[model samples]
Target: MNEQNDNAGLFGSGDEAPSNHSNNPHFNDLVAGITRRQILASSAALGSLAFLGATLPSLAEAGEQTVASQPLKRRNRLPFTAIPTSRADTISVPPGYKATPFIPWGTPITGRYPAFADDASNSAQDQAEQTGMHHDGMHFFPIDAQRGLGRQSDHGLLVLNHEYIDAPLLHPNGPTVVNGKRVNAEEVRKEINAHGVSVVEIRRNVRGEWDVVPSPRNRRITAATPMQIRGPARGHKLLQTRYSPDGKATRGTQNNCSNGYTPWGTYLTCEENWAGYFASADADMPRELSRYGLRSSSRFGWNTLPGDEFERFDATRKGASATADYRNEPNHFGWIVEIDPFNPESVPIKRTALGRFAHEGLIFAPAKAGRPLVCYSGDDSQNEYLYKYVSRDRYWPGFSHGRLLDEGTLYVARFNADGSGEWLALDITNPRFLKACLTARVTFADQGEVLINTRLAADVVGATKMDRPEWGAVHPDTGEVYFTLTNNTARTLADAANPRIANAYGHIIRWREQSRDHTGTRFNWDLFLLAGPQTDSRGPDGTALTADNTLASPDGLWFDPDGRLWIQTDMSGSQLSNGPFGNNHMLVADPRSGELKRFLVGPLGAEITGITATPDFRTLFVNIQHPGEGSTATNLLSSWPDGPGKRPRSSTVIITREDGRHIL
Candidate 1:
């Protein structure tokens, strides 16, 4: 969750059409040969479509049929050509673009922290007051009326998540461990403080550059911050802890990855891969613990340190009951935490009905006045399932703060081999689910257990095992949901959907609900893009990806207001040096034309993660995470933002067109 599993660095952080051609006759023939069972089995995978049943069309035909079926609207194309891949230690952008560094790592926000030191010597308190590290999915809340009266480009609140810490870069001596035990409490505290969300006031300067303006809005929600637990799991026994005996609250939100901003003006920062941060000492651990990938030892052994502050990382039962110690500590994380950025003092709420797992991000479906609100999320672990939450209550203008996420039904996706899928409700009352739980030997005591152990429930219900589903995005126009299945090396057998044996280079999969209904259970899905070399065979259509659009380890996906999909890459280790994919970069895709182009590239040892833009589409923001991830303190691989001799600092890049034109 925090780490990219095999790919290092701090952790953080879709679809197309069909075609017609003489060479594509095989695909067309496959489409004609599609049987009812075949259509149901592989309805989600991309291929030629023409099933006798009323299943979703193929990717090639989807765009055509969709355009033909709906009111015609002009699709926007990327204004610039694809930027070539590079090994430069700088950010590459389109020809007419200007990139400015804004709010780099350790930028002080609350004025309590001093100027950021280059030697990684900032104190724990300083870190708590400063901006967090490894900026990921973020959003810009314009400084207009509270509930979004108008867009404010010149001034706004920039809310972002600081994912995992770069231990070597954050500590003076790269984390102290003496005799197989962590000794430095302050270092661990600094790391904890660096793993949450940061809110700061940003304004455009006279020169059209964005500057961090210190204000009361500046605050950091770190690992030690207390947060209220909301939804069905609020007072559950599994959530009770010594810190919050009533089970109403708990400390911290770590591994905050991609985020979601609500129409009601709140920031939803998701907790991903948080299980790796804890160490469970007991062999007979809670069944939910191992299911979430919690283990006996962690990369940062906070449990080995002294004091209750550090001991909370030991999730094993230390006392007789859950409230006696930190047995329920891990349960507090792996949730979508909602924070009111406009009101700095507002307490963050862990929305537990979102179904806890390694949540990559949450992308809300387009809001409708009288329709139930829907939020889509993906579990980032290898072979994990995709999930979505549908609120029981309908959306209205200026609804209550936590009403949407509080009372909702959480569902896990089950993609049939034929490209069709159904959202399996996690509710135990469903008869089919009861039999599934019985088969898995999992007895659901209540709804809380079903939510706390959501992945287990998903497995019991036979959800599809994907290739490490990561970031997700909802098309503003098409109402299609896209998720990046960012590589899975552990996979051995090649399935009909995920066809690769050892899927090092990942792919993007997308789905569209019937009648564009986000709350609907049944839908059609298909592979949008396969991330790999140009020479790689195009599986079904065999012409979807090419040299100009090929990419590996697709992550950090977003759709700008104009419907341009932005893709960020995460390739590390030999993938960088051995192939044309050198360093991480960002790409832009046009859904209607099925055209993708490389828009920007980052410096050495960096993964381009977070991405956001103003409502007017003038100002764009992207994050450069862990610019020198694999390098040692003495010998660095990249020294970006500050230039060559300086230590590499992760920073956010602010971009705008020099010609003052719209981004598309």
Candidate 2:
């Protein structure tokens, strides 16, 4: 989720500005109807309320309440001393903590465990058996289920998403091209093989050091792996590509960014910026393609080569029918893919009932035994909408499965000026939504078509255009949902939900469901914090941020077992310009007191992301992605984990306390 201006061409590049949400009602219009004094008064009144109370217990709390015949007690304060920000080309942690790099890119996990070559000489076949590149949202699934879910601290399967690739660092040289076309097929294949998810079995040895263990459970699901399409949009006419004429299946998952997990023990990897991988030469593209930012060219020139596998990247109508050419290839992407880490033989399923866009990630609300299963997600592009999905059937304790995700109602949010919001259903059966579509002259044949063009449907319903909504987290005790709106440079109007214009520095917003009901259509929200430098930023209490907590672009967010909010920053383009914030870092905040402290900082040219921990909360894992991002094969910007003269590869860092105490 790098929302920098330099990568604008690869993301939301088109004739229409990304901020332009068609002719529908703008967020500014909602704010203009209220007085400024009234808006400020409402914010000040809500600032004193405690986010967590004796409300409904969240699913996170329900699962962890009883660890070993004892109730899990929540910690009231942060234990570790806060570390200062840094610019050094290495990981920085507190004085009593140790950080070790583990299983970097090209580390073989399966088959004949091929070691990584520093010169990037590994073949595509070797890449299939190794860890993927640019590790992002991750989780640790304990193999010792005897201790129950999220209770084991010794062994587990480490599942993480490989968001994307840096071709210059991936190949012997950069991408090879002759006359503006890719000349090497192996290079393209290896790049494709590096774009999915990795499942590795890891354990702690006798020395208490965490290391990767070679096991049959180790596997890689790349862009060429077979996957099944499931949900309302599955087998639709729009999904009828040359590969899957019936549209019941697709080949792979790419651009997987953030992630989620189910109570049934399945992994959910989201597809972000997936539209950039496809190119359509047609001048007049369908609303489904145009609304999601598909263009005349792709991010990587995988479509420039010969062969059906390579030609699939070129989504043009040439054979006079949707099934003849790859015109509908783009429809196969932009989904929430589910994988069972425990079962290596199972096929990944793309759950389409959860409306598709640039899904940053998905977070489930607390699952009640007889209540409907509910989850929330966000579109990562500028001015996109936030969404919620509620299953049609009630949840059952041990009988829940992926089928629960197939039949559901998807809704987009609309924030009003008074801080109260409503969830507008995206279903065509809803009279209000259908009327809005008819008024806008947008027609949909069925719910499948409405979901396929989800962005356009959101636009027609007058949903609030948010500042790039990224990861979301639900409080274990309170069930309050928090989402990070990564900075949006294109925004010029102010709204109650997003109050800043030209919002270079983003903010965190949270909401509580009405009457403690997750299935309710209403919520009450407030701004948690405005992220920027000390002089301009505001904390939870509306005071200026201190030097110890100044930051920007809050990307990855998670709440530890004890209810500590861990925040990771992605200040990509602003790292050099923003002098006060030295580099990308991680912070810990007590939501009860609004006290925040800088905990860890990553190397230069890297974004700190993907965080998880052992069940005991003693061993924590964090990822450093794309170190020395702009470096080429010859000139290196950073050589992290390894010293100088070595390539800076994206690797996961394991953090542990010297005294062997809990992380909180």
Candidate 3:
């Protein structure tokens, strides 16, 4: 999640300005009109209770009432006790809850099912068959019709995103390098094979423990997998690479972070920090490449090796046209890739209509029959923009396909000081956008080019430049959208929306769509929580964040069916400085009462991300990523899951109640 510095891309130079919002005169006037005190007072007055009451549709109007809106027959308070902060290298949960490690990195799931080696000597082919590294966003699809059971929780397919890898921990003695270039071809191949998605069959055994079940459905989609490019920018000239002269295809999805699922049961894996993986020495790089932070060298020196497959990482213009070389390769990476987990033979499609720019993740609003589909995504860089897409065609139950994502109008948000916000259409035909582009002297060949340069388009239109926006969640009952602004130390201007200067401790902001319409262009927003030390932080009620609920750098966010907001943190850079916050952890918050409680804490140097649950909500799955992240081959900082003397591995943890009841 761009855990490096506020200005830098995950592994690239921070060449772009921290924020242009302060420079826009109109934006300045919007913020200058409202005082911070007024903003906070208005937000507190519209507390959680008021928020729920005002935004929720009537039961009859909404058709069916979710479990969250039912009367007092259900438990009203949070069931578990809040745990204290800890620094110990272990998983900590509240009393009556059990957390078990499962599907760790390098565990075999497909092909011959090779066993994990403690010394990390597995081959590149072995890695392609095994579970990938750094598990992020995931979903559990129940095995219902196959087992003749409706919404079965015991058996399911676990689909998760394997984000970027920890190179030092991947090999036995670490990567081999001669000079500044990577020399070991096998190491490079294995690293590329580890970055993508994994689909595995898992089931609960009679002994009440979850285990990977050998099945034909098990598969791994790595960075080298062939994928089709779809949507408005599908066959654009800018995307024409040597491998795909027609610009309709590309090789691989990299840096997959948080994910989403479609109503038709497809998985959406987002490619984040992908621009840093490409290098170009071209003097006159286009906006499509330069705007996304392309550097002179790549994070992993895969481009240093000889061969078209490895050399594609070097995007320099060495050919007469875009199709003659890999100059257009970077355009293929930063997209929301749609994967059909049920169909192993299906090719993943990169839905380019979503307007990619280091997409952190995508979250869909609840689909309704005969209504246009709506989804939201955020750019995960300092001073980047937030985006939403509305489909041109109406959605039909059991009939909708990925085509809905292909034909859509993308919009960028502009939050104002008066708590009102507008979604400015990023369409090339929009008069305001066209004027802005002309004024900035930015020319686009077509809608495809506009989508290719989404960040630049948003810049000309003057979208609100947010902090490092990471993950987003949609409340099942109220339809309120919540996004985590994972800390931005680069922020220097204080506005009503982003109310802090040098915001090291991130905050959560939420908004309800206008008139409860998911496709509405106007909305109202408020700060849900300002995370930091007890003295500086504030909750929804304007009270100080206590030791029990304080946190920093909120990253992953999700909403259970019961309306509980699950919050995860990635305090990698500040964990030592913010000692009181302890190790990375996950917490649950009651949106109705603005009450928060710490639920789970991971081992030292790990990030708590990628959360999901079974259909019955009886079992919960959470990922502990990059434990002991900065450790070297000889100087180990942590030995988690396997204890002392063993290398640390990223793994998923299963949480369940002691009494076998539903986990709340």
Candidate 4:
């Protein structure tokens, strides 16, 4: 979902400080225990056992197995053949699998909403009453069986994020641009309503087929929905505006990309790439705002609609102070929003302790009693930093999630060249960080300021800049963290870590914390997969990719309970049309051997994203976004998931095994 840009901007320019040797004896001791040698030896022995015809436990029984406190027991190899790359305008799953197109854009969730019109003429109010567009990251929260029984995966709430809008195809004739400005106010409103999260009640019928149930639980949290601002930045001066003078609340959450689910039953939709939607007219704008690429003109020109409500997109100083106008609207976004899927009346809360950046997603580490909850997030921008947040309070059997996220310490990663890394604290109380902020021309007035300008704080502390870090996933069995570095076209210089110059096809990196501790500040990392075209050079680790395994611009990542790593592609430009990477596909990889197998290929001009499986692992859901995005009305590349001649709509595809067996 990243748009390429030159690295000359404030957020992308500087090189991070070289990694320093660790002086902490405790950190050094933790790294020595599970050295590379020990892990490699364990992997080699496990591979030999598998080769000798050893049968591992079934994936369905993995939950009953007692996971080791240290490295987890290896699972069996993935049992599906690799689906070939194709340019077809339909989803192609494995031989024994079936995919059903369920709940596309504009599907009505309430009685007041009208059915989807084929002419693409749904009004703004119609969009608010119907399902939102562009389904991205999603989670299926299983409804508990009656009388306190376990999860009922057959029925639950399906909450998915509508990342952004396909404006041309959404409106009737197209977006109305008159004299370089948007003049159609109704068109802009429809676009706005289409850019948030949607919660729908879904149920599995007697035939085991799933569809929308259309119950009262169905709800849409659009761009106009009211939301409360919480955590460290709740009442910060930078977040104050005419909309909320106390800075404790705001209007809505938009541009939600990837997502996370809490143990206590809540959905966490992350805001990403929100900077391009704002405008600031003043010449002397805030340095932090400029750093994030907020300019005088937005990509959509929503502020040109000639009203104070529409002008809220203008984030510059006006009328003398912040409260006099909507000068701080941009600051209120770029956060992880928590929504209670079970309670339709509950208001969404913006958890500000997670820091403000283009948050790709948050993947929680395995929670343990007496230990602070830990989660990993990535800033999905070029040359951005990886972040980890440690809750201030230790987790108990029934701890409150809001309290856990409200107070925590956010840390930015500093990867050393010697295979080690340190988590630099973003807390202003640290004297070393305080001195670094002064040198970077940023003043840490308070902890709220530290979080508002998160990129600046990371820069001052010398955090390692990464290639566009996207979706992250935590191993269901092991505590290892894996994230996709989706691609960085602006990188001209090479290093041992980011070895490719102009790296179009990216890589995945995995790391383990000290002593399997989620809240520990030290870690050991290594490149998991270095992806590229077939003719491209092999990775430094001597891993070669062939046509069957070639993939470009890996974006969405997830780990099913069966310990399978699901990788989704987002190939762009000439690469999509020229290489082995045909229309974006989903691939499954073994974390131990890096053995990859293509699982499915999506429709033409669509990116395969939003991977989630039912608790039973029998039904899997995948989203097809922006189909026919590169085509014109007269020359459509695809009208798939519907039929020919019908306008292509972004929708969710439910996949399962035809024989009632578990999907591999």
Top-scoring candidate (lDDT): 3
Task: Put down candidate 4 lDDT per residue, 176-229, tens digits, no spaces.
Answer: 887777788888889888989999889999988887886888999988889999
Better of 2 and 4 by TM-score: 2
What's the lDDT for all of these models?
A: 0.77, 0.83, 0.83, 0.78
Residues 1-664, model 3: lDDT tens digits: 6455443322323223342333443333466666555444423322353322145432223443356854333245577889999888999999999999999999999999988888899999999999999999898888752321248899988999998887878899988878878888999999999989999989999998899999988999999999999999989999999999999999999899999888777889998888778889998887788878777877777898998889899999998998899999998878999998878899999999999788889999988889999999998887777899999999987788899999989999898776788899999888988998898887888899989988888888888877777899999988889999888886677765456678788898888888555898888776788898898787766678888898999999999988889999988666643578999999998776567899998898898999999989999999999888776679778899898988899999999999999997
> Backbone clash tally for model 2?
1
> Candidate 1, after superposition: displacement of residue 603 in Å?
0.7
TM-score of each: 0.90, 0.93, 0.93, 0.89
**How badly does each model clash, as a count of residue pairs?**
18, 1, 0, 0
lDDT of 1 at 209: 76
For model 4, state the Cα shift of residue 119 in Å.
0.6
True-vs-predicted CA distance for residue 106, candidate 1, Å: 0.9
RMSD in angstroms, all models?
6.4, 4.4, 3.7, 6.2
Residue range 536-643, candidate 2, lDDT tens digits? 677655566787788888889999987778999888766544578878999987665567888998998898999988889899999889888777789999998677
How well does candidate 2 score on lDDT at residue 478?
74
Clashing pairs in 4: none
Judge candidate 1 at residue 81 and give its lDDT: 74
Q: How displaced is residue 356 in candidate 2, in Å?
A: 1.3
Candidate 2 has what TM-score?
0.93
Cα displacement (angstroms), candidate 2, residue 532, comes to: 0.6
